[model samples]
Target: MNICWWITILLLLHSCTPGDGMDHGIVGGHVSVPHSRPYMVYIRDSIQPNLNCDGFLVREDFVMTAAHCKNLRNPKVYLGVSDTTFLPLGIEVDSFPHPDFNNEPGNDIMLLKLKTPATLNKTVTIIDLPNLWNDKISKNCLVMGWGSTKYEDYSPSKVLRESNVTLKDLTNCIEPDVICNEDPFGPSQGDSGGPLICGDIAQGIVSFRKTQSKGNVTGYTRISQNLLWINVVMKQHKP
Candidate 1:
C-alpha cells in the first residue's frame, strides 16, 4: 500500500483505542534472558500500572520505541528493563515521540533521552540497526516482548512473556499500508514498541497487530528508516 493509505489506517487505529488513563506497571516475565540485554521498555502513566514494550539502547542514555506506543500529547518512558525491574542503572525519560511519525501504519517511532545514563554490563548489550533497504529479514525471525498473551481489553501482565514468529513475505502476507498482511503470531498488547529481531541485529520496532485470529503480520517501524532522526535527537540532548 502507499504511504497515504498507511497514514489513513493509522489514524483510524489510533481513534479506535481509548487513551484516557493513568500509568500502570506491567506483569513481567519470571525469567530474564540469559544475562538479559538492553531491549526492554516500560510505558508509564500518572495514575495506572505501566505497560511494557521492548526497545534497544542506541547510546548510553538513549532508547528507541514505536511512536504509537504512547501518544506524544501524553507521553512517559522508562528504560533499563528486565522482568519489569527498572534498575538504578536506568533512566526516566525526559522526552519522546518521533518527529515524522503520523501514527498511521505505525510509522510512529520515537527516541527517549534519559535523564541520566545507564550503567551497562556484559548483559546490557546494544543492538545495531539494519539498513533501511537491508531487506535481509525473511520469514524466519524472532520477536521478544513483555506483552500480553491474548488480545482484548486487558491490562499488561505482572510478568513479561515472549514468542517467535516468521516474517511473512509481502506478497504472501499482503495487507496494506500496515506491517503484516497476515495475522501477527507473537507479542501482544504492551508490546507495541518492541524490536523485531532477525538474529542478533535489530531491524524493526513492533508497532501494530491486526485484531484477528492468528495474524501473521506484526507492524514494525523500520529502524534503518529512522537513523537520521535518532542521531539528531541524541545530538540535541548531548551533555
Candidate 2:
C-alpha cells in the first residue's frame, strides 16, 4: 500500500488574511502543554508508529478524526501527551468514517469507539459539540495539535501548538460542506481531524489546506451540519 497520511488536498488555492476579522498569529506556535487542550489526541497506526495523525476526544468512549486517513493499520488512540515518551493514557479502538464520507475534501470526518472509555481527569476531557456550546465561545476560536510548523517540515511538532482563527463566508470554500476561515495560519501536516474550538465548543473538524498557490485559507468539516448523522452513528455504535 502507499505510504500517506489522511489529510486531503485543496483544489482551490487562495490567500487568507485576518484583517477586520480573522485568525492571525505565528505560522505555528507551541502551546503551553499537550494537555492544555485535553481533548487533543494522536492517532497512531501501531503497525507503523512513525506514521500517525491528529484526533480529539468527543465522548468518554469516542474520538473524532479525519475520514480521509489512509493506511491506518492497527489504529490506537494516545490521549494528551506532548512527548510520546511519557505514555499518558490511551485505548485500542475501531474507527468508523462517516458513511457518506467518500474521501472528499469536505466530508472528511470520522469517529472511533474506544475499547475502554477514556479515564477523564485533569488532563483528559471531551470537547463540547457545536450543538451543545454555550455563550462563552467567541467568533474567534483556537485550533491546536502536534502538527508541523511549516510546509517543508514533515515531522510532527514535539509539543502541541495552536492559532486563533475567525470564521469566513462559506461561499469562499470549495466544498459546500466545509467551513472556510480567513486566517493567516492554518493546520499543517499531521493536523488533520484536530478541533476548531470556539470557547468550549468544537465547531469544526480539520479537513485540508491548499498547496501554497494563494493565501492561507484553511478548511474544516462543519460539525453542525452532521449532527443528525453523528447522533445516528453514536446511537448504533456507542458501547
Candidate 3:
C-alpha cells in the first residue's frame, strides 16, 4: 500500500471517533540527557495538579505553549528541569492565549508571561524563532517533553523524553497554520504545548493529534504563521 493510503486510513479512523482530539505525549521516544533541551518548560496548574503541558521559553519573560493549555487555574512553570522529582520551585505565570483561540486547531498557540524574568543559564535558555516564514518544511525535527512515553500509560514521564519526526507535506496538513508529521514514534498524550525544533529554531508548537489502530499523526501550530502576533504580545506585555 502507498503512504498516502495509510494516512487516509488513519485520518478516517480518527474522524470516526466522537468528541475533540486528546492531548499527546512522547510515545516511542527515549529519555533525553539532563537539561539538554534548555528551552523546555514543564507547566502545571497548582490548584489542579493533574492538568499539565509542555512549553518552551522564547524570551526572558515569555514561554510559548498551546492555547488549549490555558484552562489551568494557577499555572506554574518549572524551568531547567530534566526530572520531575528534582524540580526547583515553579515560577508563577499569566497565560496569554491567542486572541482568536477558541479551543480549536488553527489558533492553538499561546504565550505564558513569567511573573519575573527567567534567569538565563547553561541549563535554562531561550530558543530563537524562525527568522522568516518559509513554505518549505524541513525534513527532520526534534520534539521533547515530560509527557507519557506510551499510549496505554497516561502517567507522564518523570524524566524528559525526545523524539525525531519528519515533517509531512503541507498538502497533508489539516490547516494552513499547522505543520503535520506522522511517524511510528511520535507525540501521543500529555505532550501538548511543546516545541517542534527544526534546525535549532522553534518552528512549531505541539497542538493536536489524530490517532487510529494503525498509527497517529501529530500537528504543531506553525510559529512562522503567527510571528506577528507573538511579537506584538511579547512587546506589549514586557516586564
Candidate 4:
C-alpha cells in the first residue's frame, strides 16, 4: 500500500490492538531461531489474566513496549526464556505509558520499570535504542514475539517467533510518529509492544497491523520521537 494509505488508516480507537483487523495474531509461519533473541519479554496483565503481550529490554531496568498494552495491577515481566511456561526469571512491577498516550491518537509506546533491575546475563540482554536520529536507517528489520503463529488463532506461541519486515519509507505518517512495515505475517495480537529491531538498535515498537487483505499492514511507534521521554523516565525510575 502507499504511504498516504498507511497514515490515513491510523485513527483513534478503544485500545491499541497492535495488528490490523483481527481476533487471532502474528500470521508468520516459523519458530524463533533458538537463543537468537533473548531480549523478548512476556507481559501478563492482571486486568486480563489471559491476555499476554510482548516487549523488549531497552535498559537494565526499563522495558519498552506498546502503550496500548499497559496493565497496572502487579504486571509480570518474563525474560531470559524461549518458552512462556518455562522457568525463566520473572518480575512483577508497574508499567507506565507515554504521558501523551491515548489509544486512538496513538503514541502506542510505553516503558516498563522493574522493582529490581533485571539480572542481565547471556540469556537476558538489552536491545539498544537507535542511538541516532537519522530518518533513513536500514529498512531491513526483525520483530520477535510470542504471538500467534496463525490467523484467528489467539493461542500464544509456546516460544518466541521472529517475523521479517521491512521498514519502508512512509514519510507521510501523522506527526511522523509511526513507522509502517511490510510483512506477509503481520504483528499479531499478542505481538503488541514487541520491538522492531535494526541490527542491535531498537527502531520501533509493534503497534497495529491491518488484516483481511493479501498481507497485514503493520505499524510501530517510532522510538526517535520518544527518546527524550525514555531517558527522563529511566532516570526518574532508575532502580
Candidate 5:
C-alpha cells in the first residue's frame, strides 16, 4: 500500500489561526467537548498525536472512524478528548479496519474497537444515530472534523473546526471520474473518516480532499444503505 506523504505534511503543518465565524478555534467545529462526545485518533511515526477528529461510540468499547486512520505504526485514540494534553489520558487501543477499505482516496471509512470499553463517566458520552438523518439529508447538513479551516498549505489547527455545508447531487458527484465533492470542500488531511452529522443523526464520514480544493466532501457511505452492515458489526459485541 502506497502512502501519500502530502497527507502527512498537511496534518503536521496545521494552521492555528483563529478566524471569524469559526468554532472558536475548534479545528472541526467542535467546542470544548460536547455532552455527546466526539474524539480523535493519532497514528505512530506519522505526525503529532492527540490531534482532533470526529468520532462517537457505538458500544462502550467500540469507537468508529475511517479506515485510513488506522495506521498502526502509531495508532492512538482519544475518547471524549480535545486538547493535546488529553492525549496521555487516551487509552491506546486496538483497531479494526473495514475489510474492503479502499485506501486509494474515497471509500475509506473504518471501525475501531477499543481494547477495553471506555470508562463512562460524566465527561465521556456517546451520540445516538438519528433515524431520519440518512433519508432526509439531501442538500443541507453540517460536517465537522479536525481538518484545516482554510487551505493554507499546512495542517489543520489543533482546534476542531466545523461548518454547515450543502450536499451536492450524486449525479454531479459521480461524474466521469469523480466520486464525491459537495460543499465546504472536505475535512483536512488528518480529518479522515469523521462523521458528517446532522443534528443527532450521522449522515456520512468525511472522505477525502477533492484534488486541490478546499476540503473533501463527506463522501459518506450512507447509513441507510449500510444498516445491515452496521448491525452485523454491532452484533459482534453487544453491550
Candidate 6:
C-alpha cells in the first residue's frame, strides 16, 4: 500500500483521540516578547466561552486558521494581544470553513472575514503566505500561542508563548498536504489553527496531533498547497 493510504488509515483509527480540544499548553516553551508577532490572533467561541483557538492575520480583513476551529456562532477575534488579562474588544467576523473540510483530517483550513478592516499598525499586521510549494523547508521553525507552558497545567497562559521546533522530513509525513513535526515541546490544546512559521513565511496551519502516539507528532495543513483556494475564497468574499 502507498504511504498516503497508510497514513489515512492511521489517522482514521486515531481520529477519536484528537488533541485539539484538550486544555493543553505549549510544553517547554517560553513567554514571547510583547507584540513580537503582530499577526497573531486569539479566537474565542462566543457561544462557548472556554472554547478558544489561535489564528493569524493574513490580510486586513481576513484571518487564517484551521477548519476544525469553526463554531456555530461567529467567534470573538482579538488582535495584538500579548497578555490575555488585558485585551481590546474583539472584532466581529464571519466564519468560513473550507467546503471540503467535512470534519476530516485533510482540508483542515479556514478563513475568517472581519466585519471591519483591521487598522494596520505596529502591534497588528499580516503574515505573508507561501508563494510557492517549496519542499525544502527550513529546519528551524516557530509556533506560538497563548497556552500553558507545561503539560501538567490545564489553564491557558495569560501571556503569549512561543516554542522553537525543528521540522521533520516530509518523507515521513502522513500526507503530501501536511508538514509534520515531532517536537517534544510543541503545540497542544488551544494551539490549533496557529501558524507554522518557517523562514518568516506562514508555511503551515496547525491541524491536529496524535494523542495516543509516543512522539506527539503534529500535522499542519500546508499553506502552499491551498493557495488557490485561499485566494479564491478571499476574492469571492471581499466587500
Task: Write the number of the candidate with greater lDDT, choosing between 4 and 6.
Answer: 6
Which lDDT tens digits does candidate 1 get at residues 1-239? Answer: 47654542322112233333322222222334533656555555433334334566767777777776565333455555554543333346765687556555635677777677766666455677765554556555566655554454444444445555566564343322235635434655666667767777777777766444453345666676566676777788896
| Shift of residue 49 alpha carbon in model 4, Å | 3.1
lDDT for each candidate structure: 0.56, 0.69, 0.77, 0.70, 0.51, 0.76
User: Which stretches of model 1 miss by more than 4 angstroms?
Assistant: 1-35, 50-52, 72-80, 85-90, 153-155, 170-178, 181-184, 212-216
Q: For residues 1-239, what per-residue lDDT tens digits would candidate 2 score against the true structure?
A: 11132243542111121112122212565464546778888787776665667888898999988776644767889986756556655579887888777665667788888998888898888887877422233677788766666654454556677887777565577666678775667687667788888767888888777554467667888787777778888898756
**For residues 1-239, could you state the per-residue lDDT of candidate 4 as single tens digits?**
35555554432121334333232224564667667788887787655446566888878888888887764355678878676657454687667889887554357888888877888888889887876566556777787777765545455566777767776675645447788655676566677888888766788888876553555567788898787888888888866
User: TM-scores across all candidates?
Assistant: 0.72, 0.82, 0.87, 0.83, 0.69, 0.86
Clash pairs (backbone) in predicted model 3? 24-188, 24-189, 24-191, 25-188, 25-189
Backbone clashes for every candidate come to 28, 5, 5, 9, 22, 0
By descending TM-score, how would the candidates be arranged? 3, 6, 4, 2, 1, 5
For residue 117, give model 4's deviation from the true position in Å.
1.2
RMSD of each: 5.3, 7.6, 6.3, 5.0, 6.0, 4.6
Error of 1 at 209 (Å): 1.3
Of the pair 1 and 3, which is ahead by TM-score?
3
Native-vs-model 3 lDDT?
0.77
| TM-score of structure candidate 3 | 0.87
Decide which is better by TM-score, 3 or 5.
3
The CA lDDT at 6 in model 6 is 35
Best candidate, TM-score: 3
Pairs that collide, model 6:
none
What is the C-alpha lDDT profile of model 5 across 163-211, one tens digit per residue?
A: 6666667445532212254454546645555666655566666655544
lDDT of 6 at 233: 90
